[model samples]
Target: MTDSTAPRGGKRERLVTSAGERLHRKGVAATTLADIAQAADVPVGNVYYYFKTKDDLVRAVLEAQVDQVEAMLASFETLPQPVDRLKALVRRWDEMRDVIARYGCPFGTLASELDRRDDGLDLEAAGPIRRILEWAEIQIRQLGQPDARELAITLFAGVQGGALLAGALRDPNLMSGQVRHLERWIDTVAASSTQS
Candidate 1:
């Protein structure tokens, strides 16, 4: 589904896109408006027209990420089984293993940095993560797990922790190994539920 809130390739969109990438790589504090302008090929003066402050730009980025998370979870709903849908979650991270190894999770890194402050942006930054966790919980519930919340939390922790380790160590293998383990765990859960 198309998101009207999504940036649509104009100067503002370009600025938001650039900011998102830089925020993921260099972080919010380190990424200047000038840096985003240089990346988007827009003049620094023009960025202010779209976003008066860096926080505004970060909000736009978070909005886009929330939409993305929704889209991804919706896509997984097309799968034949809840177990396959759950496995698709880990597979997504596996597909982006190299990029994640370099910069950590896009939503995760931004949220981690923003969470250090008492600002409400902490909740905003975590929107995508919260969405994913909620989606996983539902999928686990579909699999008939009595403790779906706990299972989903374990899955979220494993994926995020794996991403953290991969990024910290600059090794994609950690993410790969983590996803493999998750695949097995999902199978076990699915099998146990069937036998129940």
Candidate 2:
């Protein structure tokens, strides 16, 4: 007999997608396998068929988020100048403001949660967030800064802080300010690199 409870896209993919959405909305600690199962319209047994446990499901969600960032970086990678690539990245964020504003940045939330509770889940969640910072560093390095990595990390912190403030204030413009501040900071780095 066909497994009627099996998710349409297949168990693993559906579970990951559902888990990611729930994790984004309710956070990793707050999200339960049962919640994911309900979101995916599958049974708990089917969810278990894919993810052995909640941590396994969290890892899958983080992996998907990393894949998404990698896809985003692909387009930015080809830009001839690092500063131009940085600008393009900011522009892309402007386009994503609606979802980002509503969800409060999944990667940011994941990073915050990881800080609060360190575990295997932190390993999974922190990797993607680190990759984003690494990408920023790569762009910053193009400007020939002596401390590109440090600058990148600083910029990432600013963005995350801005996102938190925006979400707390419930103001989309506040969230966009984070992107704006980052862009301005990057421009200064680029200018200084050129003059030095």
Candidate 3:
């Protein structure tokens, strides 16, 4: 087991961080504890000390992703204008176009893969997406959209679609184009809100 007194950000942190990255790049089924152990530079046997089972580690990864989603949404809350905040969200993805082109959106890809399974873990993996939808809905509602929930789904769907195409086609431009379109769409929504 990991030492309880181990310094902060020790082996356990490394394992979780490495596993998250590997699990994103490699599908959950394809990622073995051995792979994570090697990536984290922890001994294969020691992996079991920290994570009793693969499922345990997977849950940890899901929790980390959820935390990241919460942080991203909280950061947007700091912006003064709802439209600008939404634009910044789009721009964040645009900035990651190269990475998305290579690996797709980390959360999107993982959720898509896990969603195909009948196992209950899929629901756990999807928590981050659900949180994101809720956050987006709040942002859209702030723009005075009556169908905020539906619009939020559409907005995120566009982003996910862009990531899928960008990864499949190995084209960052596709992601960038989607980001630009989203920015324009946000502007249109904001303008419509003011006129009504």
Name the top TM-score candidate. 1
| Descending-lDDT candidate ranking | 1, 3, 2
For residues 1-196, could you state the per-residue lDDT of candidate 2 as single tens digits?
5465444567677778888888888888788788999988888877667777777778778888898889988888888899888777666655666666677777888777866666667666687778878888888887888798898888777767776776677777876877887788878889889535
Q: What's each prediction's TM-score?
A: 0.94, 0.87, 0.93
Looking at model 3, residue 173 earns an lDDT score of 98
Every model: Cα RMSD to truth:
2.4, 3.7, 2.5
Q: Assess candidate 1 and give its lDDT.
A: 0.90
Clashing pairs in 2: none
**1-196 per-residue lDDT for model 3 (tens digits):** 6577343558887888999999888878899888999999999998888888888888888888898988988898889988888888878889999999998998899888888877788788789889988888888899998988998898889999999999999999999999999999988888888435
Stretches of model 3 off by over 4 angstroms after superposition:
1-9, 194-196
Which consecutive 10 residues in model 1 have the weakest lDDT in total?
1-10
- Cα lDDT of model 1 by residue, 44-158, tens digit: 9978878878799999999989988999999988898999999999999999999999999998899999988777888777789999999999999988898999999999899
Q: Which residue runs does candidate 2 get wrong by more than 4 Å? A: 1-8
- The stretch of ten residues in a row with the least summed lDDT in candidate 3 is 1-10
Error of 2 at 92 (Å): 3.8
True-structure RMSD for candidate 1? 2.4
Number of the predicted model whose lDDT against the real structure is largest: 1
- Candidate 1 wrongly placed segments (more than 4 Å): 1-9, 194-196
